[model samples]
Target chain A: MVAGRAGGEVMVRSPGRFTEISQDECLELMATTTVGWLAFVDAEGQQLLPVNFVLHGQDVYFRTMSGSAISSLADGHDDVAFAVDHHDDIYQKGWDVMARGTTARVDDPDLVAQVAAGARPRPWAPGERDVLIVLRPSVISGRRVRRQ
Target chain B: MVAGRAGGEVMVRSPGRFTEISQDECLELMATTTVGWLAFVDAEGQQLLPVNFVLHGQDVYFRTMSGSAISSLADGHDDVAFAVDHHDDIYQKGWDVMARGTTARVDDPDLVAQVAAGARPRPWAPGERDVLIVLRPSVISGRRVRRQ
Candidate 1:
């Protein structure tokens, strides 16, 4: 096992190296992290695009342009994968949390009104992102490599 | 446009919010960044898993454990999406680079010998990463959000 400085994180390693994070930790990280990648299928192949998301309970919500690639592909599809990971490459440590779920457009006026009244994920990209999609995660998995 | 601090990186924003990066810059960033998420399709649907990768010209290469999901998926497939993006959530700024390509096991003994002598992406995960997979990118696209 090696020890070193990575960014501001003090990293220590154990012989085993990687640990599986708990469900609670996975949900906590998902709520706190602002950026993640959303993977969906496209004509050419599997497409993964970065998105800014907000956690509402156990569901993930994000906005995209109505005609954007994500919006188009996500239409009428339920299966989606969202992944968030952080790395300290200098110290050879990191963690990845992945969630798989079904997605649907937030079209119900009542539900839209409810979300509008609460915290929302503001789009970082410029433009009017009117299409709101919500992902209800069915399974969550995580693995971490940290100094033990 | 808003400006702020995030993980010691200076952030700026533009009115339109997103900027396109050049091919050379994309390749350079790909080479320097050690961690990225690889997206592929499986029975469950689209999957995005993080992997440590090294850039070899236009191709991206990584090693995974023999029984790992990545190794199993890349066994006989070509279409895969590898994405690397960075963000300063404090300032609501970031960029994403995506590459679409095919993956194949690097079984050529002579080529493996050549790569062994050069800079390789050391896996951060614990395990004997004997299965070497290489992704030959066919399409590359990038977008960044920066202050004007």
Candidate 2:
């Protein structure tokens, strides 16, 4: 296995056809996309929901409506995972990037102002998604696969 | 909330812009795709991994290496979630379908033979993915978003 490190994230490669992507590269891939899946454990068990996100620096941000399931992620439950990837089914090649860490509802006025000024994430679904949630990942990892 | 039922699956809709997709429609949508993300809790916490899957009857099946992280799902841990969706970034419209259930390795000779004879899932990553895992969802639900 080959491993690379960047900050708190690590690149992992097993003895297979897939190659591990460096943390820097993982973040780059994440920045190139706006859609990802958020995995969290709720009363019904593990759930994966699709969301539109924006990457700002090392943090990920998304908008949700108040009183919604995703908006409740800010209630101090930190065990969450966000992942983004692109795949060419016809070519059978793709890459996957995953960020794991705690989630917090962005309530700080200063930070909210900065988010509004910066690259803010927009929800694809209509309605009032006034609540902004941020995911600060403690670990980021990714894998790339090429046609063999 | 508007709810619809089909067998063990249900369609859920909250007071939001998105509408709930019927269980039958969800399954039909699933059959049109071959890739999805699988969410499960391991020693490290919640994880989502992309997989190439095939829907056979009412079950979902995927292939993985024997010692890979996914292959370990057969060890009696039933808390797992699988999701598949498609979105048009330009149109800002899409649909999402999720399946929650227990996972088990298919070891029955008859079942294995049937799988070999029926539709078999092919792994996109190059490797000897001999282990086959099946997820029989207890709850299958979905949501659809349209340009408004």
Candidate 3:
């Protein structure tokens, strides 16, 4: 199997001569997913929180208060990563897709409204926030685990 | 926020402080808990499978097949990452714990006997395996989401 560059601690897996996912699989998984974690920097310089994100077509979107994480992303501060995975219960197999890209706040009132109209956000949470953020993935990668 | 270089992005966070958990809290969450994902680098690369993990004091243990993912970790391919998160009824509030480290196969017969004598490696699936793998986390990080 191909291995990515091995750093001091974290090993970033690079593309190699493996059976990487096809376009169909990516589209299927991406379409099936609705919620994922939005990784961004928060105040106090700590990895703030993993906010809930929903996928629409080729892009990722989420709603947040005028929170610090949103400000950091809007200021062209890249460091955005979002992940969504689905696993089979009986077979114990599934795939996870992670996207690395820059995130932006959608100022176009129409686009933001479209997202807000579709998303339940957190069904259990009260109230809805008006602002929406979009993430444009620069690098797309994923892998699966199955009984072998 | 100081951004750290990793993967395809940078993460800025407080070079934050980690708190020592109460023993009771640890047992309630770690020991009594049964569902969590177990990650390891297989011959095919990084693999994460959900399983029931039990805590023996500070050390967490789980059982798996004598082959596949377990064997990959034993071969010393890559460090492992195991994680579990639970949301409260409201879905807005929850806690997630991430542990990063390696797995060591139990060898000493007595130690094996001791663990087998009392501990039960509750597999999510109904089956058994001779190769019982114990997960020892080098660092455990967790967070509690509060309603603000």
Candidate 4:
């Protein structure tokens, strides 16, 4: 069991058959994946959506329609989380990587041009997704589930 | 474009090549999947974790080891969100279901016994996960991404 305190709140983690992966491994995993889930809070409440993402350095980037739910992430409501995981149901093995951070709109012409020119994320859902949002993670962590 | 007010905040959704699925369809899709991601806020910040869940009526239930990150959901930090999605990279088609709600611990012996005896969710990770947490969603929504 692991016990700690976060912002005066007690946090405990019970024993489980899983091991934490290093930050390097987490970044590698994030780089290899093209899709991930983005979680954020809106006026209604919390929302989670799957988005195609690309890793540029340590920041995660994805494109969205100008007024879509995800595009709202760049409107000053920056607290957000992103997660990527691969699970094999038959073998019951998988790994998960999660990053928590703030988001901002990628509006710099030079930076946007560079991102659009090199290894840019392609949205699966069609239509013009011209707005780019970048999530600069403050913390990144991961865990790998062990075989039973 | 779709524009509306959410809690006095302007919410906009630009044109996208995706269609919203009905509530019934969302419920059905959720019932078919055993694994979903749960998003919540803790002292550290926003967190997202994959969990194996079972649908009970309109509620979702999952087990966690005591003191685990998920078990903390029942500790009065009830504002949470759950999401399940299936994506086909080759086909470029998929669907997503999201539920936003509150969580409560299942302590009733009879209900616990019944859940354990029924279509209870079996965690892929090895552990004695005895604590059951139920998410009662106040809103559920979904969308289907069309093939490009």
lDDT of 1 by residue, B75-112 (tens): 76777899898877566677789998888888776555
Model 1's alpha-carbon lDDT is 0.71
User: What would you estimate as the lDDT of candidate 2?
Assistant: 0.76
- Could you estimate the TM-score for every candidate? 0.83, 0.84, 0.51, 0.83
Interface RMSD of 1: 11.9
The collision pairs in model 1 are: A12-A147, B12-B147, B13-B146, B13-B147, B14-B146, B14-B147, B78-B102
Cα error, candidate 4, residue A78 (Å):
4.6
The C-alpha stretches of model 1 lying farther than 4 A from their native spots are: A1-16, A90-92, A117-121, B1-16, B119-121
lDDT of candidate 1 at residue B110, scale 0 to 100: 55
Candidate 3 lDDT, tens digit per residue, B1-148? 2223333222223222234455456446665455566554344433445555666665666655455455455444335666665555454455666666667776656555555544542333333345545667666767655344
Top DockQ model:
4
Write candidate 2's Cα lDDT for A17-41 as tens digits: 6889999999999998878999999
lDDT of 3 at B23: 40
Give the alpha carbon lDDT tens digit for every residue of B17-73 in model 2.
688999999999999887899999998778788887878887988767778889888
lDDT of 4 by residue, A72-135 (tens): 8877555799999887767767899999888988777656655555443355566655677789
Residue B108, candidate 3: alpha-carbon lDDT? 58
* DockQ-superior candidate, 1 or 2: 1
